[model samples]
Target: MIINFSNLMFITLNIMSTLYMISANCWINCFLAMEINLFFFIPMIFSPNLFNMEMIMKYFIIQVTSSIMILLCILYYKNFIFNLILIILMNFCLLMKLGSVPFHYWYIEISNIISWKMFFMLSTWQKLGPMMILLYNFNEYIMIFSIIMNSTIGMLGGLNQISLKKIMSFSSINHLSWIIASSMISEIMMMIYIFTYTMMMFFIMMKFEQMNLINIFQLFFFKKKMMIMISFFIYFMSLGGLPPLMGFIPKWLTINKLMENKFILVSVILIMSSLINLYYYFKIVYYMNLNKNYKINFFIEYNFKFSFYLFNYLIMTNLSYLLIYMFYY
Candidate 1:
């Protein structure tokens, strides 16, 4: 139950990085903040026996390469034609940092090797700075391509994966498409997407951590807990952007705005890819429900405090659309 010094340091540095990002007045400042954020997170991955050195090395190399590319873009911003090229390169670097589509290989590889806490940060918080930067200076055509690639790749990537972490990585990529699309429409919509996505992922990661569940097959261990299974069904369905759930609100708003702006084709693509992602979500729930006849006593009981928290979280997630409507309208 004791806290480690590295954990404490990571928290402090993460906060500082976020604050710097929020208050950044120039590209240089934002880049430095991102560097600090990456440096701090590297230490969090440093477990003596459990950590994967190869994954750490790959992450470091990719991120550092992107950082250097960003710096070069900033340095050579004066020329007219070269500036245009640099801007495109900058967007690529940011997209790479966000682990979107074609640049997501490192992310999937690293996610499989990291601890759940680090995975939570990587999947959620680590996206904030780069995404914010992308929103500010994004190219319209590039963004459209990114949206298509992210949605298509994310949906296809998770189809054959048994590892829960790999599945979640693809889910993150899928959600990244929606988030990027939202940003193209409105800042408020983008913020809403980020918040909902973070909350849903946090809850899912917490449940997985508690159960020590890392593979889709391991979900069978909790087959007796109907309440937990139902909660997970709702959670994953919401994440897949099903209607009347917390996750759909941002997507609904985004599609409305896109259509208003005459982006009918993009909206259709988004819908189709989301349906593909939902197929996998339902697959996970089907697997969980399949072993219901097994009467093994492997079900773990939650403590009173966690049980109360889980109940509230379930209720809140299920009814979250009402809250969103009340706030927005």
Candidate 2:
């Protein structure tokens, strides 16, 4: 992996943007940080290959429009009715940037064309600043709407997709719904959800990149590696929020919080959507395990580090019951 000057600049800008969001005292500064982040990300997306011109244009237009909307909201923060409208607009813009439901088409399109590294950033890190800002100025009605729509859309959108990237894109949206729901109850829970989600996505992205896989059919080529197959099973199933997995911990906590707050309908909707997601996740695992001829490849290197990290996460998740008990007791 060779790092170039532009890549270095991109990393610098990303850091600055994140720092600004963390330290921002006002909405103006947060908006500026997001702008800087978007400006730098565009170059990073295009620098790898110029053929991504169309995708780049789409990304730029969407981000710039969102930024402009956010700016208008900031400028009109005084008038009650006007401010409410602007705030709703601002929420919609941020949702667009986050690639949540109804605004996720552009993100899915772009994900198919970009490198897995860029996609990883887009799926995880890129969401941080926008999510933080949205959480800070949280709106219950808008958040509830986003939560239901995003979860439902994410579940249904991925059911027929052959592209791995597209599947993950919808999965990202599904997870966003949970993250937003958790944020409504507790910021700490939301942060925990983000951390766990990022780690899971990172592991899956690295595996996909390592195999140079882009679609479901490509997974068959690596059928000889039982380790890889098992890992994939664990990772994807965990992502679907199966019990006794790291992904389930945050979800379980979120449900508890929701129930405590009498948000029964939201909790039920979340669980139903998760079950829909689990169907696809299981389908992937079944496809991977359909064949049983194991061949050893000496040339292929394994990701021992990530595997160990994942194992640790599994152990920690199993112990989470005790942690919860201690907290409650």
TM-score of each: 0.91, 0.90
Model 1, runs deviating above 4 Å = 49-51, 293-323, 326-329
lDDT of 2 by residue, 1-329 (tens): 24798799788988788879867999888988899888888877784456579778989999999899888888777755666677788889899999888898999999999888889999989998888889877668999999999899999999999899998889899999999998898767877788888888888888888888898876666645655766887788788989787688889889999999998999999999999999999888877777767775556455886567557456535465457435532
- Model 2 CA lDDT for position 184: 95
Q: Model 2 off-target regions past 4 Å? A: 47-51, 79-81, 295-317, 320-329
Pairs of residues at least 3 apart in sequence or in different chains that clash in candidate 1: none
Q: Candidate 2 has which clashing residue pairs, if any?
A: none
Report the alpha-carbon TM-score of model 1 versus the true structure. Answer: 0.91
Q: Give residue 130's lDDT in candidate 1 (0 to 100).
A: 89
Which candidate leads the pack in TM-score? 1
